[model samples]
Target: MQKSLSSLMIALAFASATAPQAHAASNEDVVKRHFASLVAGPTPKTSELQMFLTMMPKGGDLHHHYSGAIYAEQYLEWVDKQGFCVNKTDFRINTAAGAKSASCVSGKDLVADNAAYRALLQKWSTADFYNHSSGKQLPPDQTFFDTFGYFNDVASTNGSEGLQTLKKRAIAENLSYIETIYEIAPITPDGDFDKLAAEGFDNARLNAALEALVPKLEASQAFQQGIQNYLAHLQKASAGVDDEQFTMRYQPFVLRFLPPSMVFSQMLASFKLAKTSPQIVGVNIVGQESLNVSMRDYSLHMQMFKFLKAKYPDVKMALHAGELALGVVPPEGLKFHIQEAVNVAGANRIGHGIDIAHESNALAIMKTMRERRIPVEVNLTSNEFILGVKGPAHPLDLYRKYGVPFVISTDDAGVTRHNLSNEYVLFATRYKTDYAEVKKLSYDSIRYSFLADADKKRLLQQLDSRFSKFEADIARALLPAK
Candidate 1:
């Protein structure tokens, strides 16, 4: 009996030692391994990866800005068509044709001059960031913000055309939706709201002052006509776009550099517009966060949003908070902007939450964000170009580790001379992220989007179908000959 037991034990040990590995490689695993191999070498071409990503189903772009998204070439075309002129000295596009400035060149002449046209492209985008032959080199942060002013008039003139351009670009890139941030122009209010704001930080007086103007502004035929024009532009832009192929929504934003009165009034108008219009989904506050006016009135702006949000609870809010870095603003400035935006203003999604680590009690904020599922819009190229933050210094991994949801985005693809595919490529190459992580980021883009529940479900279903086919194709390619 002892000998028989010993033989059985020996047999069992041998069987355990000889058995194959327990878990087989999943389809995702196989795909990830192939991806790692494809991107293995230093300075890998990644043309194959780019092709794959270009065809890969991207969900939505949530952090886009409409004016900044238009390519500089398109803006130049609009300038030429509008009979505008460009100031050679500063490269500003003047809408009025015959300005009596020595530097002003007619759009026709500028287009004819290849050198000037190329210069305009460089000035209006990050084109000169890497290669600057002449002129003073501006700081990257300043350069990025300054580009907007140069192209503002051209963008204004070509709103619908810009939308059509963006829609076509998005379709070609395989993106399904975009929540673009734009302004409903003629935002100036008849009343002097700035005077009330200059009266110091008195919330009651500001509220009273703005309340008086809301009804007047809402009833203004000009305001109503502006909304109609915006709607018509969208209709015209989306004329032939099939509803199933692509969808878009707008989040009208207020410039934070404006005075408190103007900012508040604009905020009020934005909320009212969102409440009344289906096209405008939410309100956002945008501008250089480090500027004196924006920083000084940061809390005040939050209070205004808080007030308006309470009044119109259904109006969604996405604030551009903590878009600052160390040199951009003093250390103290970084700590509270995101906190106030979240706790005080109740921002549903935080744009460019780059200063999270600098915030006081940041862990608590991360905890709150995780618990509430408050996602951050992560723009990789924009962050690297604007803030000089990337790779380990970036808070992307921190968000993942702490369970805070985030979606990859292109803040201004055209301005940066990049696209969503390039963003995914950077993310994968920089972080060595696996297939599951990459897929989740794409999924989360739509999952955390402000789209209505039914629409979100339908888009998600579309993604599932697309991914299934993608995985199947990948699996078949990876298989060995029978």
Candidate 2:
């Protein structure tokens, strides 16, 4: 791992040093040169780069997760206030319904017990686990996926407050938009439907089954009621998030680990929401993609996506395909996830196209993405923590080499304990990306977002203005005096 990382670092250093410098339009160009100095050659100044990134005009976080973006600290702040407490041993929050449990510790008292409080924070996030070896750490993948369970109940307890906090943080970083996987649609099992769906992977047969079954699923009162509840939850969570400087949108998703019938039910509901809801911009499928259910039904899920997208042609889609690494799954499993996502499912955008190189037709996939302008949402921190794929071994440069559009994102900032600014720092320094491509990435975020054309134009214009002001201010304030 260390050897591969060194090679990657060397690759970045060479690119930054030898790559043509971005041309400046006029003389008051101190900011551009300053940005270059921090990222070029060996030993790039990561601290200064992070500071510069914080002031940069990032257009949007196109691959954010609602539950994972809000930090555990924020959740803890609401715990005692909401009449909740934490379990001293397991660290799960006791929701109102579970308030009567005597086994749990109050939030206030947990904080008072600094040691346990610190431990809870660790379990809730990736902090300290990387640097230290002990403390009952699960494997990285397990630890990452398990965090949602630890805080799931409290994460959504007060969606409005969480949304506000997310907004304030984004504005502070000068980001103008966020396309978050806020929540998923509800699902109910159809044992009979599952039995039929499980019988085969023949696309025609599955489509026929779905075609026969969806009307009944849609007509059912429980499914309709679930959709109503989802809309209400979204409306409440989205209250007051958008303003003159910031905008937010949702991509209701489905957990792919569920049974075929349930996955289809959820995706159906999510696509329905995407077609009609102004704030719900797209649909996505999310889960640990390496799990048995996810891997076994991988193609099935893609076919499910293919089926729904045809039904709701207006609804946009961004599937989380190929979040795998070698040895984590069988070698064969890595070969076709991203290809099927783009070709079979017709993904508008792909989140964490991490296993791109493993695909049988990797170059062909890149070519298709370039032609279609389908952007891959790259999450440096999340990838590093979850897949241990970073530095030169990461496929970011491969995507760049193929002219494929991509955007930097914070997949689960709260869990990874980093923000978009930090992601930019990682991208810039590791790839030795100069200010110009970095600037283009910022624009790409807005360009690839599943927002309406009008909202995209509005945010793009705002980003342009924000960039001009940010550069001018940095030049005036930080430019070295002659």
Candidate 3:
């Protein structure tokens, strides 16, 4: 591992150094440098790769989901150990006898045994996620969302272990921090959809019914106790001396698929938790924002944030906005997500922002973001996988063109099967970025993070020193005989 890493570091050093000059001289020079780095040997270069991989810089994953970022394989492994079955039709895992389903709807058989299940999980996740679209019958979203249930059996009992697994992977990729979203508040087994659907005619009435049910959700000492249980897992996983202290902060995400009132209550409770519990950071409305209720209540949600922002001004807001496409919603809906986030909701950061081109006063919004220093967490892979926005077609270039502050992140790393390095590589190759600019992007991740000012400054200093050493080492190798 160490040897491979060193080689990778050396390869990266050579790649970064030679790439610019070679590209300028001739495109062939660029190709040659790239190839040379690829074949760079393992003894010393592998050590460099190891160093590069293990060099844990203070990272803040601004657009991360706690559940989705954890490996499906790990969860599936746990499920198998617990004796669960993979429902063949949906590809969702269930207790052995409960669902009576098979592998998936596409007719893939469930591998109940450990070894085969592990391999299948790998195929379904980071290992071959970016690669195998050809034979995979699942839609991207379905494939992505489907993993949750497969691992749900194990994850339900393995909270801290799940985070530890996530943190371990993150640290392996040189990330030091994350502010992840999790569903600590459970949606009841008894509070089934049909039961809830039957209670009300519309969202408002549904909310009233849900409010009546709030006592039930809260009454479950199980639900309330789950928060404490999850926190215990965080504390246990994070407890250490020399190891990078993985600071876990939560964003209680309200499902937008629910009626407005239930969703609103969830959001409010999340905001309240942000004030009441140090572990719970803020609130996020997750799921497809392109849905009708989501778009309809967009402004109201912003108003909701406005209320919470007033109550707990210190609480942070990093919302998913402008995750839409031009054709996804009415022309009017595109004009205002990012704007409302800033103007009404007072979001600390914005996620995606892919549809910024269609937004009215987009230029002004970018300018304000630049002036205000509101960082946009850009997940290149998710944009490609979920929304099919990428390359020059992505509004990220526009954000750059207007100098809107941003950072590259893995939105659903486990689902997208990506790491921060891959995200950086994509940005570097696609945008033709410089080392300094890439370093700036890294710095921006921590600098614009929700961490306290002092911590941010300290981490920034650490990043500067580390990047400087990396550059100095690279320059030494590249320098002509002096």
> Per-model C-alpha lDDT, please?
0.82, 0.88, 0.67
Model 3 TM-score, all chains together:
0.74
Q: TM-score for each prediction?
A: 0.88, 0.92, 0.74
Over the stretch 1-482, how does candidate 3's per-residue lDDT look in tens digits? 99999999999999998775554433323333432453345422333433443342536687888777776656656665566666543446566455444343111234545555545664455445555445645655455555555565555566667777877777667676677777644333334534655453454654455456556656766556655554565556445411434555567677766655556556656665677666666677777788777887777677667766776788888888999887667888899999989877888899898888988989888889999888898999988876778889988889988989998888888766767777766665566454446556777788777776766686677666765655555444544557
Model 1: residues with Cα > 4 Å off, grouped in runs: 1-29, 39-47, 98-112, 133-135, 190-192, 202-213, 219-225, 480-482
Residue 405 C-alpha lDDT in model 1? 91
Q: Candidate order by lDDT, highest to lowest?
A: 2, 1, 3
The digit string of per-residue lDDT tens for model 2 on 37-78 reads 898789998888888999899999999999999888877777
Q: Best lDDT goes to which candidate?
A: 2
Clashes of each: 0, 1, 27
lDDT of the structure predicted as candidate 3: 0.67
Top-TM-score candidate index: 2
The superposed Cα distance between candidate 2 and the true structure at residue 477, in angstroms, equals: 2.8
**Model 3 per-residue lDDT at 101:** 40
Query: How well does model 1 score by local distance difference test?
Result: 0.82
